[model samples]
Target: MSGPIHPPLCRVDQIMEVMQAAFDPAWGEAWNRRQIEDSLAMPNVFVLLVDSSGDLVNADAGASGLAAGFVLARHAPGEEELLLIAVRPEFRRRGIGEALIRQLAQDARARGAERIFLEMRENNPASSLYHKVGFEPIGRRKAYYLFADGTRMDAITFGLSI
Candidate 1:
């Protein structure tokens, strides 16, 4: 693989593209533009993204390269919650996700957050990355994610104290 990936700090308007790149339709994890917009409108919401376009030299110039992966999170008093994190299907397994998580943790700590929390479907393979970054299982919400075909999956919650 190439050297470690360098991700850009995404602008608010650029969230949807990176989000779409990072999620799979089959997993039902993709958030629509409206939902993302609404979330971003909330106080203390932040986003981290990787744009691989290779041409991005300025983040404020709207030419910050192409979308690769992203993480959306919310910071409340003393805590930060990772609401969504995704790597484009083509970008998986290359450490983009790990970089995003690591940076998010560091950013949260810098902002005075005491801990970080994230919840995902119990079967999500990305949980391994979380574990590798020092996150530990804190709780589970039984049958929290319901499928379209009448099936359900538990929601696994992980926590990392900074």
Candidate 2:
């Protein structure tokens, strides 16, 4: 089922919690308090999500009010890069992640961006979602992500012209 996804205004803390939980420590590093604080301070940053009953969903409990997923983006000059996108584990296989990406693309276009970009771990489970939404691999970074377990993973950069 489709749900309304909008830019979160006062739910930054909740979003950060969910993001950290959904992101695997073995695949990529999770955002720290300081990083989240900095990102929220930037005007170019946008955090969008499908909140449950106008409340931020929690990542710990399966039924946390902050259910579904989230998408984070930041504008840079001529393009907007999707910095992060995550759906609750129980919410997977649904279209929540795809919807978030689509909304992010639309937001990018609305902001005069000619293209949208994102980087995913080489073996990220969400890679299929990115590809399905028209993102194509345009570049790669060797050992770009340092996981929490001290392992490194290559990053695959994907882009789509809006």
Candidate 3:
């Protein structure tokens, strides 16, 4: 007898689609295809992709739905660092980001992570979302992110004890 089908996990191409739609070019926060590919190849790296309903997707298989957002993170000895996260612009303010973070925390804890950390530009509006998710500002790097136009932004690091 056949078992019930499960939606396929998020893939790099789907993540690239969301990244292309979600990130503004001026911020330069999105990763290139090669970077994502390389990161996924690492054993300690993980990714979660979700649709509008906050479910995993595989468009090619016509299961669930197209990917609406994704979170990529890396695990260390006792910590997990949220490396990247993005949701399609049209899907913003709909709790997709929060879903990703919550899911990431669950997965990280499973991997033995005791703390979760992330760094973002000071001007990024997503800080509020991180705060809402229980992350607190822990540190900062002055003039850390240099834009192509010669502008610089401070990077604020947030941490949460999982």
Candidate 4:
């Protein structure tokens, strides 16, 4: 927590752990190891985060040696999509998420992407974080997310011109 938060090139195992913690099955589709492995294998996909010393933080603090935050993204031929950004619940409001966003935007720009986009549930708490990092809601998809209870939620698509 003392050192500056910076994005580290994360391994597949680390990415899976963070994704599991961030996206529970009840909340949404839980990404399995194979899925993560495939994502890591993709030429355009990247999984990265700020390492808290030797530990990997996801978005909250529960495990030792890792902070609680991560950023998953994919850069296609001309655009980039921020697939996921998660900080452990305990680590919220500590600027870790913001740092991750900034890093992703920089990466996107470096990849020659003119625009970056992300989709989140309209009611997601991290929407403000996206806004703070220069993302603006440009579109919406009705009933884009489904809860375990069979209810649906709207997906707000945010975009930033890089």
Q: Which candidate has the top score in TM-score? A: 3
In model 2, where is the ten-residue run with the lowest total lDDT?
A: 1-10
- Specify the highest-lDDT model's number: 3
- lDDT of each residue in 12-103, candidate 2, tens digit only: 55667677668776554467767766776787887666653323343333433554567778888789988877777767776778777787
Q: lDDT for every model?
A: 0.74, 0.71, 0.82, 0.70
| Candidate with more favorable, higher lDDT: 1 or 2 | 1
**TM-scores, in order shown?**
0.84, 0.80, 0.89, 0.80
Model 4 C-alpha lDDT per residue in residues 1-162, reported as the tens digit of each score: 222122233455555566666665667755677766677677778765655432334433432355467777888876889887776656667787887777777777777888889988888878888888888999999999988788999999999988
> Which residue segments of model 4 deviate by more than 4 Å?
1-9, 53-64
Backbone Cα, N, C clashes tallied per candidate: 1, 2, 0, 16
Q: Estimate the TM-score for candidate 4.
A: 0.80
Q: What is the C-alpha local distance difference test score of candidate 3? A: 0.82
Candidate 4 accuracy as lDDT: 0.70
Candidates ranked by TM-score, best first? 3, 1, 2, 4
What digit string (tens of lDDT, one per residue) describes model 1 on residues 29-119? Answer: 8788777777777768877666553222235455454567777888898999999987767777887778778878888887789999999
Q: What's the C-alpha lDDT at position 62 in model 3? A: 53
